[model samples]
Target: MQSVALLLIGIQLVYAGKHSLQYFYTATSGLPNLPQFVSVGIVDGQPFTYYDSKIRRMTPRQDWMAKSVGEDYWERNTQASIGSEQAFINNINVVKDRFNQTGGVHTYQEMYGCEWDDETEEINGFDEDGFDGGDFTTLDYKEKRYISPVPQGLATAEKWNRDGSLQQRKNYLGTICVEWLKKYLEYGKSSLQKKVSPQVSVLQKDPSSPVTCHATGFYPSGVTITWMKNGREHHEDVEVGELLPNEDGTFQKTSSITVTPDEWKKNEYSCVVEHQGKSVTEDEIRSNKGDSVPIGIIVGALGAVVLLIIIVVAGYKVYQKKKGFKPVNGSDDGSNSSAHTVPQA
Candidate 1:
């Protein structure tokens, strides 16, 4: 299981030779202070466009995206997102009816994407739907069919299969999607392909608390953090966290291990981070107090740095505004669709 976990992380993070384009759509019911519908476009793991029911507009999230397109593009995508908003709103209720629920917080989500391997020139596509955090249906691009894990999704699968949607999906994923992905890569090559190394630190709260190894501000979002004991891989009492995005499009992650102070005094323990063909280690944290900083102080310093970055970004945006820069926007086309039918009672 550990090896499998590492392999999956590698696949998600090691994108030096591969690229992907993905879009996520989400709708909810009975939730307050949140948009009823939201759509996001990501190219190679970085968000480039976004829309929400509250804003009712499609907006670019990156500078390249804004500069590469015109106002017409934003208008078209906004219209498309408005249509998707209604469809997804209806979809949430339809899914709720399938589950035999009348009210409460419920969610419906769709994720679709294509992957390109530069070295092999291989292309792959995926589409999936979920309800209340569980898999509802998925598209088998290879078989050109839909698979439903629960009975509730059978009707949707059947309808999609009979409606000539499979061929449409196949063609889009195989050709149109790939074409757009390539265009995006070319347009944003400098920002998308650049690499940034992480700043690693070992932190401890107190004598009895677990030790945490943190890596932040790394690009490409692919990193592995492991604990080593006596020069061997250590796994006991270890907790690995999910990858989280930073404000500047980089990523951060933490992995912690629990060990007694006595054990630390006796054995050699180190934190190893592997990213982008480079390895970083803080082997002296266990034995040297000078190297292992207190968690509270480190967090405070990080908070200050984050505030500084935010200020700098705000000033830069103001500068762009003074220079008469504007935001830009995507149309849904058939590429973005619900592609699901509600099950009948």
Candidate 2:
């Protein structure tokens, strides 16, 4: 049983290679006049700045965002896709063709994916919109009847189960994903120039409240945020959040620790932000601190500065080396679909 499950995930990671994939496919067009549903995709969970399903056209993020696809061309492609929605849905037959006994009704479904996190050496998590909407049944390598509720959460799981042609299509999707990223990197190279040294702020809910460290508007999501006291790293009462998208194409994360007023006043609590190979200790950003660098200062003679882009590939080799998973990369918890829309079994 485990072998079969492992084999399945193996196929997906093989296609994904190194980059993490965030894809969405939707075809919910009930009315006659509304624009056809747009299938959006993201390379690393950011907006699908380049590709749209209507034309299957991929371009640099700048071109796509600037209407380079053109108003006339976009409308023509959109209308064509809207007309083909039924056929597209038929190819997959996501409706009556159930994957498991899980049950529920979901008209408008979504697909969410988080392929690999190289920094953490983990395969993040998977979300297949409204696939089988229910709980699960377990079977060991011994006698699990079938993967009833399809494990669309694994990113590659859905496409692997499809026909050979479809599977190939998915594989190519991953390949093209890398190309799209490379284009964006070249087009928006300067977006990487602004280095806003993290400004760490601590907020307590109330007098007797817990403390939260907020670091926002920083580029290249490699910043390691941790709570420290008296020069020691503390994880115990620290609830670190995943890096989330900020409006300005930067990233934000929060780590909090519970402390009483006494500890808060002791001035021993500080948040540490490690970015671009330098470490800065933020002592609640009180008056004792000033701007690291005005951020506007020119660095013509400052020599080379390395900035990491927000993409996920560092997992391909490790994923291959470790088989499907390792104890450290999280468990094979099963191709379980926590879909809230899986119909009642």
Candidate 3:
């Protein structure tokens, strides 16, 4: 029984892979730079930057099958042993047909195929993939069935299932549309791609001096601030504070750190502002307690010192060998310096 289940999963994965479903999976899974929903507005009369929610929240659909089946029905069948399987399968088919009719593919699978019995792969109900996973089943039921990694929040779950089908759908669709438009303005893609930005801010810092750092102009509501000391990340030193909203409907955030002057000189200090799983922007300024020389000068100085020491040691050894001195033999007078003697003595 389990073997067939594994086989089906393998086959679906292959189908997903052969047709490049992995890309869709990854695109949906939060790959940077690909594209995702974001927010946009004028902050202090200036343009706001992009934002991505790594895991988009789930919402109920306008035509959610669970709702159509009735809340009472859903709650009852949701926990039933064999009935749950039937209900789940039925929802899968409904979602499949809906997406097909709309000329779109929701989630990763082309069509969700549910099992009627453990042994035989049979047809059942289904739901749309792009919508919130919450709309479909109870939190425990979802964990047991969908195998989705999205965290289940009590706040979302409490009201999501109880709401009317149309209400849930409107709420779900509206928020997603708003997010989608925001992304359209920012990334110009429907889904967010996972990729790192090429631009890196160079920071100034003294190896031995301690300095304070802060950031302004962010949607303070959903952002976090952290410090990267000398390229090494230090999460412990982070101080997150309230996000001060701007007059134009945007937000601003600030983060700070204090370290000794010596640490700053040897290591770089970077202020990383993070939202979701990606770094929005990292502003860095550099200072040095030792000598404010170009990196090239530091490298050159170290190299010169090493070379000089090697040359001096090499010259002394060469001079001794040239004079035919015996290193281990003592002079006849027993002086400290070793002496050379002819083979005949």
Model 1 has an lDDT value of 0.62
**Residue runs of model 2 more than 4 Å from their true location after superposition:** 1-21, 26-36, 43-162, 170-174, 192-195, 260-267, 277-345
Score residue 10 of candidate 2 by CA lDDT.
16
Q: Which model is ahead, 2 or 3, in terms of lDDT?
A: 2
Please name the candidate that would achieve the greatest TM-score relative to the true structure: 1
Worst 10 residues of 3 by lDDT: 305-314
Tell me how far the alpha carbon of residue 79 in candidate 3 is from the true structure, in angstroms, after superposition. Answer: 38
The CA lDDT at 112 in model 3 is 16
Candidate 2, position 60, lDDT: 33
Q: TM-score for all predictions?
A: 0.78, 0.51, 0.25
Model 1: what TM-score?
0.78
The runs of at least 3 residues in candidate 1 whose Cα sits more than 4 Å from the true structure, single-residue gaps closed, are 1-15, 277-345
Error of 1 at 21 (Å): 0.5
Candidate ranking (lDDT, best to worst): 1, 2, 3
Q: lDDT of each model, Cα atoms only?
A: 0.62, 0.37, 0.26
Return the TM-score for candidate 2, rounded to 2 decimals.
0.51
